[model samples]
Target: MDLINFWLENLPTMIDGLIVSLQVTGAALVVGIPLGLLLALGVQAKTKAVRFSSMAFVEIGRGAPALIMLQFAYFGLPQAGISLSSFAAAAVALAWTTSAYTSEIIRAGLEAVPHGQQEAAVAVGFTRIDALRFIIVPQGLRVAAPALLGFSILMLQATSLCFAIALPELLSQAYMIGTNTFQYLPILLFAGLLYASICVPATIAVSLLERSLSKHSA
Candidate 1:
């Protein structure tokens, strides 16, 4: 009861940190998704060079841990005269790492599009680009919706990386509250609730999208 009351009293402070968390998630997604799609397309390219280069980039990113990536961006870049704010460092690292996984998701989505559909689009006098933009991508995204949403949820959770860079996001705020009150369990519980509150809706929405796509196929 005391913990609940304390959290309620400090709701405004927690919310302030939550805003930063959302900002990090939103910004990373905005930057990462399109880049990921492009990377996916590159991976699918007919040319060997394009495919190999994209594959290499994705492999390197996926091989490294996100924490190491975040630390590199925050600590290492300054030596190169590129000083980034904690928020910026976190966002870049999240976007880079998430893009690698998202690229794979997108590539699989693209491959899942029936070859017959692409041929049908071309038969109707649509350019290859038009077919991809219209028929291929739409179906691919529908097929990929659940996976993409799962990735988004992962990205949201990964925003906790901001704490390492001294960004006062949700985890950082919870840490501060825990340190001050010496009530680690309560602080962590509230943080977990906050994370769940953000993720549950996203999961539900994605599940609905997947179901709808399944019905359309049926």
Candidate 2:
């Protein structure tokens, strides 16, 4: 009853923090996925400069830990004269990480596409850009969708790291509440449940979608 009462009292604050976490995740995905697709293509480009630049970006994003990325965004950037709010910093770091990781997934999907398709597109009077925009990108994105969805779930959990930067995300809210109440265990567990509430459903949905896509493809 005490635990229940505590949670009920704090639910509003937790939910508010959860909303901020979701907003950051959404913002990151919105920016990252497109950048990911472009990086996927850029890394495969014929131009050496483009390919190298994209490769470097992907490598750095992947190599750095997410915590390091967030810290750099929130703390380090201001030293270089780039000031950002905590939310903006969190979004930027997560987006960079997402773009790097998703670029590989997207690239694999792009590569999985039949080479003959591109040939046929060119043979049928379609310009390279038109063929890619209309056909290749669509197919590649469809192939990558399941993996992308799964990654999004991971990103939602990763948003907890924003607590380090004082973003007042779910974990941050829970921590503040714990500090006030001195009930760390129950509060942290509640935060974990909140994360699971979102991630579990998303994970199940991604699995179903993947199975459906595979069935159709097969």
Candidate 3:
């Protein structure tokens, strides 16, 4: 079929783009999730300044659109005497977004752990930090893992937004191919399928993870 032939012809270029996409997603997760955990803790800190600052960051990151973040990183920062390549800009922006969103998810997970557990840890003479480290955070993060995995999948899809900044990600590659061949539909469809191939499996894995966690907890 024409579509199959078209895909075969373009597969190598698309694969290259996909590798970049995966790299970006991996980098974002590696940096962002830890930052998110810190932000979640900061929001829960007793100090008003720490809490407020954390809240402000989370609000701004969550409030602005990811596209705007990407644009600002790539285009806006140069005006302020800071410059980053498109790949660096995209990674930084996406990481910020990931941290902001995942902080809330992580916070909810922390809260979901019962107060009784903290008390039990304290009664055993554990310091507050130890209680959190030994009792609260571990369980909370486990509870949050599935949701975080799901979000990572969403972020992977959101890498398409980087195309606007001229990152040679999957969608960008497809667009370039389409522009050259003037075969928009087939190329775009192949791009869609490529995204689906990753996301669909990731989604199913998250579901399985959630079920397994539920069973383990029960």
Candidate 4:
């Protein structure tokens, strides 16, 4: 009951932090998903150079942990005469991770489009770009929708890691409250519940979307 009371009292401050988290996540997704689509296409490029470069980008992004990336963006980059604010660094790091992983998700969807679809487009006088734009991409994105939504939920959860760089996101705010009150256990528990508050409903929505898509496909 005390924990409940604490959560209620702190909810407003935590909500502000949650808003910052959402902003970071939105920045990541806006930049990342489109880049992911490009990477997916790049990997399939006719030029080996482009393909290899895209592949390398994906490997590096996927290989590094996001925490390290955030640290590097915030701390390490300053040594190189580059600097980003906490929000910028968090957004950039998360976007890199999102793009790397989502590239594969999108690539899988793109590949699932029947080869005949391309052929059909070609037969209809569509260029490769046109085919992808008007046909392949739309269909592929629909197929990928559920997974992308689920990944978005994970992305929101991932924002917690931004606490390491002092982004003042939800987790960071919770940590701040804990430090101030010296009630780390209860405050953190409330923070975890706050995360669950967002993620649990999102997960359910994703599942329902998946089932609806499945039924339509069937």
Indicate which candidate wins on lDDT. 3
Encode model 2's per-residue lDDT on 1-218: one tens digit a residue. Answer: 99999899999999999999999999999999999999999999999999999999999999999999999999999999999999999999999999999999999998888898899889999998999999788888889999999999999999999999999899999999999999999999999999999999999999999888888862
lDDT of 3: 0.95
Predicted candidate 3 versus true structure: per-residue lDDT over 56-153, tens digit per residue: 99998899999999999999999999999999999999999999999999999999998889889989999988998999999999999999999999
Local error of candidate 1 at residue 131 (angstroms): 1.6
Poorest 10 consecutive residues of model 1 by lDDT?
9-18
Report clashes for each candidate as comma-separated counts.
0, 0, 0, 0
Model 1 regions lying over 4 Å from their true place: none
Model 3 / residue 152 / CA error / Å: 0.6
Q: Which ten contiguous residues of candidate 2 have the minimum total lDDT?
A: 209-218
Rank list by lDDT:
3, 2, 4, 1
- State each model's C-alpha RMSD to the native: 1.4, 1.0, 0.9, 1.2
Models 1 onward score TM values of: 0.95, 0.97, 0.98, 0.96
**Candidate 3, after superposition: displacement of residue 54 in Å?**
0.5
Residue 126 lDDT, candidate 2, scale 0-100: 95
Q: Give a tens-digit lDDT track for model 1, residues 101-207.
A: 88999889989989999999999999989999999988887777789889999888988878888989999999998898887788778888999999998898888
TM-score of candidate 2 to 2 decimals: 0.97
Candidate 4 segments exceeding 4 Å error: none
Kindly indicate the candidate among 1 and 3 with the higher TM-score.
3
